[model samples]
Every structure is written in C-alpha cells, then in structure tokens.
Target: MILRLTLAAIAFAATLAAPLRAEIAIQEVTSPGGIKAWLVEDHNIPFMALEIRFRGGTSLDQPGKRGAVNLMTATLEEGAGDLDAQGFAAARDGLAARIGFGANSDEVSISVQALSENRAEAMDLLRLALTEPRFDAEAVERVKGQILAGLRADERDPSAIAARLARARSYGDHPYGSAGDGTTDSVTALTRDDVLAAWQGAMARDRVYVAAAGDITADELGLLLDKLLSDLPETGWPLPPPATLNTAGGLFVEPFPGPQSVVLFGHGGIAFDDPDFFAASLLNDILGGGRFSARLMSEVRDKRGLTYGIGTGLSVRDLSAEWMGQFQASNDKVAEAITVVRAEWARMAAGEITETDLATAKTYMTGAYPLRFDGNDAIANILVGMQMLGLPSDYPKTRNDKVNAVTLDDLKRVAARLLKPDDLFFTVVGQPEGLTSSE
Candidate 1:
C-alpha cells in the first residue's frame, strides 16, 4: 500500500511539473482585516495547502523558560476551543483535514491541508488551534514526557552530541546556541502559565508570513486569512539580538563509547542576499554539497576509504550563517580524514576547480530546482521560506539563471574570500585517536 501511494504521488508530481515550470503567477492578497499573504491559485486539485510562518520562534522563549514555545507548539493540535485532545483529533479526522505546528530556532510554522468542500470547516478548526489552544495540564504533562524522552535519547547519540556542541561553540551565549527542545530539567520545570506566555509571544500577526497553493482564489484566501489569523496579537515578542560567531579554530573532541567518530566542521558563510551567494553555493556543491560527486566524497570515501560518506553545505539562518559539514569515520581513520578535508579546502581556496566541476554543479543545481515544486505543499512551503529569506518575488524565475551565470572567476573569487582552512573548527565525538580540543 505504501509503495502504491508513493507511485501515485510521483505521478501527480509529474503532472504538476509543466505548469509549475511555466511560472506560477503569485498574487499578493490582503484580507479585509489587513492581513497579507502570497497566493498561488490552482483549481486542478480539490485541496489546498496553507503555510504560515512566524519569525522569532523558540528564540523568543523567556530566558528561564527555554522549552515553553516548543511545548506549546506541540500541544496546539492536541486540543483547542471546547474540545479535548481526543475530541479535537476526531473532529479533524472526520473532515479528513491535516494540521501541524512546529517550532525551531528561527520560526514557528503551521501547515494545513483540506479539500475545497471542507475548507471552511478546516479553517475554523485551524483558527481554534491558533487562537484558543487549551494546552490542558494533562496534555502538557504528556507532551513534556515525550520531549524528555527524546532529550534522553539524544544524550546517548554521538551525532546529536556533536551537533549540540558545535552550536554551543559557535554561538556562545546567544539563544541560537541553546537546544530548541530545551533541557530535560527546563522542560520539567515548565508550568501551564509558561506555556500560555510562550503561545502569546510566539504567535503574532506582525511576524507572520503566509502562502497558499492549490484550489484557492485570491479573494477567498484573503477572507480565509482574516478568519484564521486576525485575532493574533499585532506584535508579540521582540526578536533576539544577532549572534556573533565565537568559534576558535581547532579540534574539540568529546569522549563517547564508540569506535567511530562523528565530526562536525565549518566556518562563517555568506548571507542569502549577498550578490555572490549563488557562486558560493556552486562552489560548495563542487567541494562537498554534490553527494557522491563532491570533492570530499571523492577524495575521502572513494579514494582513501576513510569514511562512508562526507558532505557540506551553506546554512543561512535568520540571525547568523555558516558553512557546515559532517561525517562519521573509524577512530583510526579520523585524523587522515581531517587531513584530506583540509587539503581539499586549501586546494579549492587556491582555485583548482575545472570547467567540468562548474558544469556538473550547475546542472545538478538547476535540474534539482524544479523537482522541489512538485507538490502544492512543497510549493507553499517554499514560497513562505523565500519570504523569510527576504528573496524577491521573481526569485523562482531567476534562480536557475543565477546558478548558470556563475563563472570560474566568480567561483575562484568566492572560494578565496569564503574558504578559510585555518579558521575551520571541528567538534568530534567518540574515542577518536590523535585529536585534542584546543581550548
């Protein structure tokens, strides 16, 4: 059954490729209550996908109330208005609607899908979730237990440890360094009042970005927007201050009971709006973002047999950005792997890429771009993400051209400016030999 469903989804996606490639005409919609959204009308499907994003997600958690926002988001769909958890779930299931909410470091996102015939009822359900979430005490405790269980599991995970350590080292005292799920102790300490405060602070109209796709017209979407979000506060919480990278380059190893080491490495990266962002992206692709074809994969895995897989990419965040990479290797081979990685970094900085490298990277990037617009939900999510990154509306049309326009000189210049082998920091977890923390 899963395989059959997968094939059907793939066929549906293929049907959308042609129309999507022709340019989806996005309409700027304004509700009667003054809320705004981006709408892509497509009557071919009977359902619509709605994506709403609010900036200052978990980062807006009060200093001592670290996990409150995350917990609140989890409980939004658990119950709302006059319904208990099971009651809400049954009502939503009866309508065959889907609604989800989640919080990360930069944003709180809500996703909804409902058929045109049941959209009005679905919107009311969504409105209830947003404006009148019960966050019942029993539900809160249940969700908190689930979160605590995950936190405990992460404590035993080498990859999770390395990731947490990397952010802690990179961002220092900033909220970005803290885990979005909060610590077990912090979560255990949360009260119902804390959850309510987090909900109030994180869900507001001022920071909201909305995008809708599928069977929805502009006028209808505008009215739906007012119905769903007009009750949210005009302004909720102030965003956290920008984080400065505090990393000092060197290997930082945490001893774990494993023969293999998980390594996370990176340096500062270009912002999304920078003119040379696409060049840096292509450079990253050739160096490590191209999966099997990346230089790191070719040199480290294919040639040296040091690790199973290695890859890197740019991370453009709301308040900060970095070029990051990760890989796992046998304890004895980790030193060699790091040596090879640094060599590749230095070689790229020295401009050793060939025309074939540029061509392959461009082809992969451009060809893969269209596949992301395959489904209405995917398109809606991308539209909201583009807004979050401050991208222009024509970005969808011009994105591939920007990728294709990158010249060898552009890659060379960007590589020289952005690649800093000496500044690279490594956070290694496991019993890796011959590696020591500089600090």
Candidate 2:
C-alpha cells in the first residue's frame, strides 16, 4: 500500500513537468546480441525510464480469440515465475520500481522506472514477468472479471456507442472495426491457453522496439537489452491485412436514451510518411485540433453555442488512417453543430485560410512540441514512438523547421486535396433531434 501510494504521488509530480525546451542528444545502441535501442543520457538524475513496444497488438489475436492479447497484457503483473500476485508486488515495490503494461489496436507497451542503484535487479524482475509469467487460473479469472465489467459498462456509454458504430461504419470487416476488448461473451470464454497464444503472438523480439533515457550509458543499455529479452520467440503470428475504409459521407444515428448526443466525425486522412504530412498537420490545427482558437470551437461553441467542444485529428493506425473528431451537445443542438462543422470543412477545402491562421498554428505547434520532453519518462516514450513511426532519429531537431516552412499556400493546397466536406461521416448516439439515419 505504501509503495502504491508513492507511485500515485509520483504520477501527480510527473504531470507537473514545466514546459521546458531542451536539446536532446539521442544515440542508437545495438545490443551484443543485436537488439537495438535509442538512448538519451542524463546523468544529473539517478533514475531512468525505459519503454518497450511491440507491433501488432490486439490485432494479432487469433480468429476465435479476439481479446486474448488485451487480457494477457493486464494479467502480466498479477504473477510470474515463482511469484504470486502479492509476491510480485512486494518484489517490485521493494526495489522502488514502477512497471506498467498496456495494449491497443496497433501496439502493446511496457513502461518501467527505477533508481540507478537497483536498475539491474528491477530489470531482472521484469525479465521474469516477460518470459515466465505464471498466468495462474486465479489471476486470469480476476483480470477477466475486471474486463467483463468494463465491457458491460460500455454498453450504455454514449461515447463508446458512437465509437463502436464509427469504427464499424469506417473499417467494415477488418480488425480495426471491432473493439480491442472483444465482446463479453468472447472474454468470458477465454482460457489460459488463449492468453499464452496472445503472449507469443504479440511479445516477440522480431517486432519489439526499445528506448531508454536518463542515468544509463549506451553500453549498459545494450548489455541490459540482451539479458532482458533474448529468450522470447524470434517471430510470432502474421499481421492482419490492411483495412479497407469506407470514406463515403453520411450520418448514422444510434437511438440511446439521453438528453444530449455524442458524435464522432471524420473521413480519410494523410499518413505519417506522406510528403505533404506537415502541411496536413498545420491544416488540422487551423480546423479543429482541440485548441480553443480552432475554427470548430470558435464557430460551434463561441459564436453559436451549439456544443461545449469539438475537435478533429489525424488518426493514423498501423493499417490505415483517418481524420477524425468528436463532440457532445444537447439533442436539439447536435444537428446544428454538425452543420457548422460541415460548413467549416467546406470553407477549408475551398482553400479559404488566411495568413493569420497559418501563423498562429505554426507558433502553437512549435511551442507545444518542446513541452512533451519535460522528463525522462516522457523523453523515452517519445523516442520509442518516433522509432515506431519510422521517423528519422534527428526528427526532433528538424521538426520545427518543417512546421515553420509550411506557407499559407501549402496549407491551402493540402487542405483542398485532403478535406472532402461531402466525404465526412457523422456517428451520433442518442435521441438527436431532427436527425435521421442516412440511407
């Protein structure tokens, strides 16, 4: 309990990181056994954060085991090797290490933090969890119960309803269309073997990426890497085929009891590797990238009072990408809010951006980028994310220049090509007034 409370307190401190703009020197280290990781040396602190990610997360679940990967990830900390749940917690807390595991559609992540003095022991503990997880029946059932409860609760959540419908309408038969948690039926039926399958399918060396920051040398990181992961299978299940998106525009209303409606909207989006991505990013900021100065917020909330908030983003996934947004409003106002959103989309698609809009977006994006590197954990996470995205290691240094080089004309040209006002689809969940399902 004491260590858990200490971790909870550390979370509050982590979030309070000042928006500092510091230069980061990143080095690529390859382990003796050929494992590669990105490292940032910060000797001022006697602590470190390490992040590891594996591609093909829950999407690797076998045909009949939709939620196996997610379930396995949750149960990783429950027990491993000779340790029971309580024993594992006691060992980790004794070393003052905080480790976490998580999964989504595209990737599974492991995060760890430990003081320099106990880094080796902490990593060894993690090694046991990764390579020899007990997956005891009791542990599996407990985590399964928690996931089942969440699935049941999602049945009535308007946001979840809109999200489910949106993905179904967008991705069709692909794995992206369904929930990562699977259905309550599928989860309840999962067995210990299914969880083991998920572990093998998702946690292999072939698809893993690693990064570390603070109080560790490149040589030390390299040696540690091989000790931590050399035993995993070299390969696992094949990745699923790409998702074929339905970009056709229309409104789909799900009837749920509520005075207000939740809506998700978007269409096809640009990919990270696209040459015009920087332009699309600046354009997204000007449109509805969640800032109060965004056009959607200004039109839908400030001027017309149709909704409390509305924003859009470039939602890129392993197999597909889409430009998406969400907002909530009174049932009577949902239609109006969407109308205003459509108008703004059309206006932007028509290349109607002003120089002032471009300047403001560039400044805000550039300034906010540095705030992401406030601590060792944040920097390590960024390093792994950049690797996963296939970005160049020097991206941090060149990123601002790319944003600054985007001229007003660049956004206008990219907006015209990227935004299809007519292709934007809306998924609304609730008794939205004046809204009827599209044919």
Give the TM-score of each candidate.
0.96, 0.97
lDDT by residue (305-331, candidate 2, tens digit) is 998888899988989989999999999
Taking the tens digit of each residue's C-alpha lDDT, what string does model 1 give over 279-367? 99999999999569899999999999999999999999899989999999999999999999999999999999899999999999998
In model 2, the clashing pairs are none
Cα error of candidate 1 at position 51, Å: 0.1
Find the 10 residues in a row with the least total lDDT in model 2. Answer: 10-19
For candidate 1, the per-residue lDDT at 157 reads: 97
Clashes per candidate, residues 3 or more apart or on different chains: 0, 0
